[model samples]
Target: MKNLPQKVRSKKLSSRVDLTAMVSVSFLLIIFFMVAAELRKPKVMDLSLPYYDPKWDNIITCSIGVDNRIITVLLDDNNRIVTYSGLLFYPIESPKILSYGKNGIRKELEKRRKNILEYSASMGKPKNGPIIIIKPSKKSNFKNLVDILDEMAITKIDTYAIVNDFTPEEEKLLASK
Candidate 1:
């Protein structure tokens, strides 16, 4: 009996667990988890620029200056500092007069339209930053402020400086001039 190998052949085959299907299931699960964990919400908030020197003579710009203190402006789609009518203001104050029309903002946008277009084409920047500034004395009249703002908006100046104080850097530049 021992020498005669048992001829008992099993008819039932072992259940072969196909791991390929399991692997596919695991991949699907991983993808599900990865997609579920990703964030898809849009966020919103204020995106104003950094205001340099928030405190000072409180620049109140107008279209024209009564005295010769008003800096001469040049506009050729590159330097839009002012127009003939409205005024623009930062650190918002009740202007005695305004050059930019009421509720008109983004003054610098008009002035540097040429530079902005060139820069946008070459550097991929959508708009150029205007570097114009007005340093009116604290006692400057409202009409002047109105006139300057009017000119500023017409020219398209989004960013400007109000000389409240001559920082050391400015003093050095002025002293050299």
Candidate 2:
């Protein structure tokens, strides 16, 4: 009786695992990394060069050198600033020696621009305005060039040139400064 008559029983258990939460967490981590790994944008300055035109004969050249000096000249037999219409050169005003800033070079530029506008209006000619040529000397640093460019923007100058070559007069002026 002890050996033959016992009934056998077995217990059942589930072997499955819930992977939804794990998969969701993995996707969230992936998305977080993707969102956080974006690259930064670089800063830059925009500059435009003036197009050549026979009608645009009037040119204003500003030479920037070291020692915080700028020599502004208009294209003529004598390098001088133009005072009014008919290409009148202001012999009294030799390329004004100016420093950098709102009070210094910026003020001078605004005044010059104002003069050009007045001259064009009086002459009954469409205001092409004076074409500014920026010439930076070897002694001039990058900061000086950038400051001048900022001045150009602040002054609302639409036509300008960044000339690499300097005239003999400009060289002398730069040397003197």
Candidate 3:
């Protein structure tokens, strides 16, 4: 028998998957999420605190002047706000319990502001706004303070202070309520 030539065999090719597109897409999604998170930030409110100095303590104690423009607000428990004009001992406006909102403290603020402006102008003094002294009692919540501060901002009040110290008279007055 004559020998036959061996048949040539074809080589099989191996299948491969391209991962470049998938990697790029995953990276793009990550970047997009990061940028979105950066753009969304929490809103903040600005506060201006008084600067303290040791040397001014003596000077403050010695100074004696009646400022009718001063308004003191005391924040007590149960969302009670006690407000008065001038010194607590010699108040121009008697201490009154006021609630929150436009009809409450806001109305009083606007009325006092207008009166103060008129009084200052008539006295031949520079048109100065009312000075608010916010005294938050220990029993009061933080929200009360923030709400009052918001009121000050809404009324366009420029001069205000957040004082923690309370006199004996103020304590007794708050106790009565």
Model 3: weakest 10-residue lDDT segment is 58-67
lDDT, candidate 1, residue 88?
A: 29
Off by over 4 Å in 1: 1-113, 129-131, 138-140, 161-163, 168-177
lDDT of 2 by residue, 1-177 (tens): 478867877876788899999999999999888867753345566333334445437654222111012224322222222112121132224555666778776787787678766755665544545556676766666677777778889998777777777667566655654
Runs in model 3 deviating more than 4 A are 1-66
Weakest 10 consecutive residues, lDDT, candidate 1? 63-72
Cα error, residue 37 of model 2, in Å, equals: 52
Which parts of model 2 have CA positions greater than 4 angstroms off?
1-92
Candidate 3's residue-wise lDDT over 1-177, tens digit each? 899998999887777889999999999999999998988877676333344447656323212222578899999998889999987756788999999899999999999989888887776655567889999999999999999999999999999999999999999999998
Q: What alpha-carbon RMSD in Å does predicted model 3 have with respect to the real structure?
A: 9.6
User: Candidates 1 and 3: which is better by TM-score?
Assistant: 3
Candidate 3 lDDT for residue 131: 84
**Candidate 2 vs candidate 3, lDDT winner:** 3
**In model 3, how large is the Cα lDDT of residue 177?**
82
Clashing pairs in 2: none
